[model samples]
Target chain A: MAVASDTIAAPEHSAEGRSETIAFLIMTAVLIVAPFFIYPLFLMQALCFALFACAFNLLIGYVGLLSFGHALYFGWASYLAAHAAKVWGFPPELAILTGAATGAVLGLVAGSLAIRRQGIYFAMITLALAQMMFFFALQAKFTGGEDGIQGVPRGKLFGLIDLASNNTMYALVVVIFLACFLLILRIINSPFGEVLKAIRENEPRAISLGYKTDRYKLVAFVLSATLAGVAGGTKAIVFQIASLTDVHWTMSGEVVLMTLVGGLGTVFGPVAGAFVIIAMQNYLNALESWVTVIQGVIFVVCVLLFRRGIVGEIAHLLRIKL
Target chain B: MFEIFGIPSNALFSQLLIGLINGSFYALLSLGLAVIFGMLNIINFTHGAQYMMGAFMAFFLLQYAGLSYWWALIVAPVVVGLFGMIIERTMLQWLYKLDHLYGLLLTFGLALIIEGVFRNYFGSSGLPYAMPDSLRGGQNLGFMFLPNYRAWVVVASLVVCLGTWFVIERTRLGAYLRAATENPTLVRAFGINVPRMITLTYGFGVGLAALAGVMAAPIYNVSPQMGSDLIIVVFAVVVIGGMGSIMGAIVTGFGLGVIEGLTKVFFPEASNTVIFVIMAIVLLIRPAGLFGRTA
Candidate 1:
């Protein structure tokens, strides 16, 4: 009877695995082809946010940790990358690495402090710390204060391929996003990922099972922060700006909105969310605060009746992983 | 001029008064948060927005109804408190079954909507609320000067804080609240309407924030973004004080405010972040908070 039950569960697992891979392939194809029809700038922005949201999802979805202040990581990286590119005259890729390193260091400090508290306190601690950084950025000289680091030269790729053209920059962004996305996929399926899920499902239980859950959480946080930095750094190169807006609490809320709208725990939810939200902001730019109002409504709606989100619901209906 | 630690007495005293005023706001705000969290088991993220609304309410009362500061002080919180009750009944109640984080998220969304709407209508600039005819002047305390309105704010805040503390920690009604806080399910079995209590508790807590807002209008510019900005600092105050105790919240709120004021006088660059720094240090030394007994 036990073997029969296990066999049935095994087929369900295989089906989910198969569907997940299929979805990723479809997503990849769409991402590659989407730029042809859509405006590349808008597409690139959405992709950066998508990658950012995906990194955010890795912590919240897999580890069940909702970081309310991810903008710190995203914004700090953008600033570092922009400063490195413009001032240090580094190559584009090296600038991005510098940004990622900065974010990792920040994550180490922030994650260490934040992990000391649990649940709601954790969210508040991250927010307060981020606010502290925001104040720091406001006072610090290198960030250019309110004006931010503007006119950041995209420079060359590995000091060879010129990236001044929009097309080259777009392609580079796409490639970097894909690479990071795949790395996220790889991490999510690893033993480390399983332990993260275990910790998320029940931290006390995971701890009882001899897992140093804090270390796992810290590692996941650093990974998530580094990737978010990658997205932010690339964004700075693409847009040639890194400003206070990126580090603001509103930006943090925006990422959370994207994750919530797409699907909290699904593979492709952040991608869908980023596009939908960015598209809304893009088209509704004339409407100003209405966009904010609309986002708020979506948040309320998402929390109340539709927690599964667009991708999660679709995945659930299809009996497949997203 | 006399000097304390090489700083002039006047500068120190004036800054201390500023800190006390700031701490009063923090105390009032954190007190509301603690009250709400005690009963609802959810941190009120919409608190800042509601406080902003309270200021707006007072502004509207003065502009449209020709109400005076005293009238707005009495009326604004009541009006805003009702709105809070509506939100509690309609929205926040639904989130009780889920993780406490959802409550934070929902309130945060509400805050965005409220602030966005207000920003759309009024813009981000601060609107000055005129002081009353009786409270326009200042008093010389020999070494330092004190504005009448500022002095009133400190006194009024003290009354409210102590009144709340007295009611909650002393009265018979307080016993019921304590019972509900300890175990709602057990209390509900004794023929009490626990859900209604929860809603009212949320409303009362929100009312305290509105009261603070009404008080704050004359001191700070009544801006839409005011509450959201202050709330983060209040969160740090709550963390440092430990949200578990009313007295803890009040004491820490005022103490940190003083500390922040002193930082401004000594190291102005660090003024904005000193509270957060202290919060970090507190988390390291006492993860639960100074007064917090539980995790």
Candidate 2:
């Protein structure tokens, strides 16, 4: 089993190196030219969700921990960042950082509590914890309950560039997303990541090997939460609002769908998955109530037969790492 | 004239009664979850939706078919159980070879589809399921007013939960079920149909959830959103109870429900979230859950 994993790891390592180059090139081209073709705001929304899905993938794919409650971190951070920028008059970068920090702290606490069990129990724990957050947001005055914290100012980026313009905001988001994405990629290839994979395959074996598995799992959880926070924070700025929908259990499930649909273990799978799902959502949103039914169908289909997901299947057919 | 914690005994007792009622539903639902988990190794995310389906079934029976609540009680669970059986046979049976997480994901998807369709057909707003004429009105306890229907709910759920417990824990049939849960292949070797047992177990679990829905209809508004919200709290309850023991799920369910009621009295703002807070604490102190065996 170890040898099989290592063989898989070898291809993945070379694949990661190749994909990073491709990603960087694609991002550069998009930054330079895509704005002319696509709407900046739409692109910004996609980037935010893309980052969120990638962060989510970090835990589920790499660590083999499927968190059904990630929206707590993402939604809470969005609320904090929205409130900070809108109510406290903070700069965009600071607000975003504050959101990420909040998510890391929350992840630390939630991870400590959730990592007590394995597999299905772990998923349930995270889900229940996130639901608790949803209730908190529903009642907390700062969250404004159903009204939410709306009309948030985009504020200035790094105290210099004005984000009120779509083009500048898009550029800013693209940079933040690329940095976070690369950071995830780097972590996946690190020794720390290998231990996570080992733990994923067999925790008892990993523990017997004298590795402090808990510490590694905790760090991975925190990192995933923090990056998800970054995505949520960016989303708040782009939408100029943060609502209960951001924190709902449904949102958490949506992210899971994105990751699963993209490819669970693949590095770039979540990004591809997020784009496809977000675009599908966008298209379905025009159809009103049918969106949820369609999303549900997609989820069932994916789980029942399409386990490799869009990117995973593509990677397999193309004979290349995603 | 009795007093506890500086509050009137009437108010306290009344709240306790409400807590017990809520706990009954929780106990029933979590019991179903544990039973399903035992045999199928799948957490039925659609349990809540199916529960909602029970209430809807009762409502539709009354509204369209002119059947009474008593009749619906007998029929709703059977209908919902049949739906569950079909689901297990068709879609869920395919997932047994994959990771357990896939089962969770698949059930969650089914839940979404069920809830979404219900919401689309019925609208997001709640529909009222009127109390049957036979079960309407209050009992008027000397200290506190005990609504007759509420008392009926509490008693009915307790009976159902206990009956389920008996079937799963005490009966010879239950021994076969337990043996299958422990080692299905061995049970199969003994000439017991393990696969059929799994399908029936899932059906029975779904039926339990539907029964809870029937009990809950008059107490809470019969809404499309009803089960989706309640299921998450039940998930926490399951975690707290550890899904290890039948009686544990029952005890934890009722205990958490009472605690939540107390929170309502002490801090109304936290009422909705108290169960989750307790789950967090439970996870910290007893990660395997109160009744769950250490993994």
**Best by the lDDT measure:** 1
Candidate lDDT values, in order: 0.91, 0.90
How many Å off is the CA of B256 in candidate 1?
0.7
The sequence of per-residue lDDT tens digits that candidate 2 reaches over residues A1-322 is: 5557778778667866786678667866766687899788877887898899999999999889999999999999999999999989999999999899989999999998888889899999999999988988998899999999989999888788899989888888988998998899789888888889898888889999888998999999999999999999889988999999999999999999999999998887888888888888776687878777778898999998899999899878977776
Please list the residue runs of candidate 1 whose C-alpha ends up more than 4 Å from where it truly belongs after superposition: A1-11
List, residue by residue over B167-188, the lDDT tens digit for candidate 1.
Answer: 9999987889999999999999
TM-score against native, each model = 0.97, 0.97
**lDDT tens digits, residue span B50-85, model 2:** 999999998999899999899999899999999999
- Model 1 over residues A1-322: C-alpha lDDT tens digits? 3346447767776777788788888988887888789999999999999999999999999998989889999999999999999999989999999889988999999999998888888888889999999999999999999899999998989888999987888889889998998899889877788789888889998898788999999999999999989988999999999999999989999999999999998889999999999999999999987888888888889988888889999988987788
Least well predicted 10-residue stretch by lDDT in candidate 1 chain B: B97-106
